[model samples]
Target: MELTRIGEAAGQRQTPEDLRRREDSKAANNMVTPQEAKERGITWRVAPPEPQVCQFCGQPIQPQGIVLQNMVFLWRPNVRCTCEKAVAYWQEYDRKQAEEKARKEDEERRRAMQSRIDRLLGNSGIKKRFQQRTFPNFRTDTPGRQKNYRVAKEYADNFAYHKAKGDGLYIEGTNGTGKTHLAAAIALQLISEGIPVICKTSSDLLLDVKKAFDNEGVTEAQVLDAYKKVDLLIIDDLGKEQCSDWSMSTLYSILNDRYEDMKPTIVTTNYNTDGLINALTPKGFDNTKIVAIISRLRETSTVMTMAWEDCRGK
Candidate 1:
């Protein structure tokens, strides 16, 4: 009984302390000691390997060379190059190539646009003989001629705005003035700038319509539509044609359609507005139709008086 009591007292005091010590000892054993590592040939410190060579030029890479790893390019990447000179050469080459490509594209576009302008002007029925007439070449010698020339030039220069605002011109005056010359000059200038234009004398247009009625495969609609749809229609010599019922009616239809559509037109006449009205309203046609046509002209057209004496030497 005495031995059992003594052992129980010792056991109670030592049990917790000994259990903690045993746990600490087990943790210490789990750690890798230096001696054990050496015996196992495990290295804790090592020197890094040498840097990679330049894959591009097979040259030695500089310490501060640009380095990109695992990169993808259009032609096989993961490429590293330290050749600054070669890289610069290729960059310049690519830049020049891009510039050349852009230049060619621009040139091609310009040529195509010019070709389209040429075709439109050719098909516009502007007399080939008058193609050379231009505002620059029109005579500005005398005071009166110079005045008319300046106005015509201004009109030509500002034609883009005139077309946009649906404005037109009624260039009328005495016989010797260069009305037709200025009108043709304006037409050619606008045409050169890619504006669609048609030029025809009043008599010629009426003659065309008459020919269309008599000729097979030619229709009045075709002849009239050509005049109606152009961007600019030049009707030269307004009262030249005889005022028969058919002539007046055809003229009215052309003018009325253009007026309703707000299309711009250039009209040249040897008579003033009143004179033109008188010439058109002869025996027994409709005076209202003549009034209507003249009214639209007065409303939309800028009246330009070319008072210059006839430039052509009599």
Candidate 2:
């Protein structure tokens, strides 16, 4: 315990010989200055190793090209002079090495993530025509149009919060009013951030399910799972699809599952609630189920009316 206390008290302090060497290092700056030497605490070497001049600071470096000066290397560490450059050089070398290693690791992670995102976007059903849509490109010519833009942008930005509540956007407008444009823009923004969003017209959604039944090598459950479980599912042109009992039922199934799972769903439509009801009212079609779906949508979505003049009407 006495030896432990002495060692602890001497922690990190230069020995007397090392201190004397630095105190007189000015006189013999470029040549090996002969001094009393000791090896290990119990053994002494007959002579010191040969010295060389440092290329960095032009000072007499430690003997025998010794580079290791760092602590925690208790056996035969190079105890350096104050003006030695190897310490600083190795420090900088370690810093650059750590930075380079971090950069390469980050790039590898980014490439892997990008490949995964490519597969997701390809399967997202976002058409190439709308791939270029973005918030900055959206026109805000009027107060109403500006409000629509603000709402859409805010929704996309705060999507994680709304998604937590299963809340989404219900875009209502006439054709050519840029409803789908705003929806696609939101999807693209989320996609660029690596969020999993699936944008498809309801017709194409039904058609994909139909194809899955034929030879697509996929099951109906798989199709429904994708739509029902995506982070955000944008169903564009909701009422434009030619509705059948089966098609509407399938749509309801997807929406219902998404609702139960508390997943957000964005729907763009050229129809009001009544117009949507009328559009869905086919010959002897069941109205009860469609009304329930609309009610749920009203509860879970923020209604954004984009009835302003078409910004593209130039």
Per-residue lDDT for 54-137 in model 1, tens only?
A: 645677532211112311111212234548865776688789999999878856754554453344333555677667778877
Quote each prediction's TM-score.
Answer: 0.59, 0.62
**Candidate 2 residues 7-115, lDDT tens each?**
9768967789878998667433322323312232222233445566666667764542111221111123244545646778778778999999997885676455445
Residue 79's lDDT within candidate 1 is: 30
C-alpha lDDT of residue 193 in model 1:
71
